[model samples]
Target: MAETVSHHLGKGRLVAVEGSLQISKSEKDGRTYTNPQVIANEVRFLDWPKDSKKGNGQSAGYDDDNFDVPF
Candidate 1:
């Protein structure tokens, strides 16, 4: 099963996600991100968690993951 979400992004708007995802800027916006290449830029896997109960025995809850960016 897969989940999909929609959001509004502005000029220089940025988002980051873990694991694999598809990312794109809507045609309505001048900024355009397309296909696998665009997906590649935004998806990252966080460091494996110390706890062993989640996500292929890898990642834990979001709080345990590092968000190094200042936003």
Candidate 2:
């Protein structure tokens, strides 16, 4: 399932996270719950851009916003 999702990312930077939902029964309510458990060693990063800092890396028209940020 993860492979199919990454393939659709189309050469973009993709992070592969391998894990499974651990189903457990709650003793208090007898309800089943799914908890995500990520395998620390299985995480991967793929397809980084050639230039990390391309085109100033800023959103257009954001530099000239007229709103006062009263900290």
Quote model 2's TM-score: 0.30
| Candidate 1 per-residue lDDT over residues 15-56, each given as its tens digit | 455444655545546666564523322333344334446647
Off by over 4 Å in 1: 1-5, 21-71
Whole-structure CA lDDT of model 1 = 0.38
* TM-scores for every predicted model: 0.20, 0.30
lDDT, candidates in the order shown: 0.38, 0.41
* lDDT tens readout by residue for model 2, 1-71: 34534333345555565555454444447766655554333444443434344356332222334211111
Please report the candidate that would top lDDT against the real structure.
2
Backbone clash pairs for candidate 2 read none
TM-score for model 1? Answer: 0.20
Best of the candidates, TM-score:
2
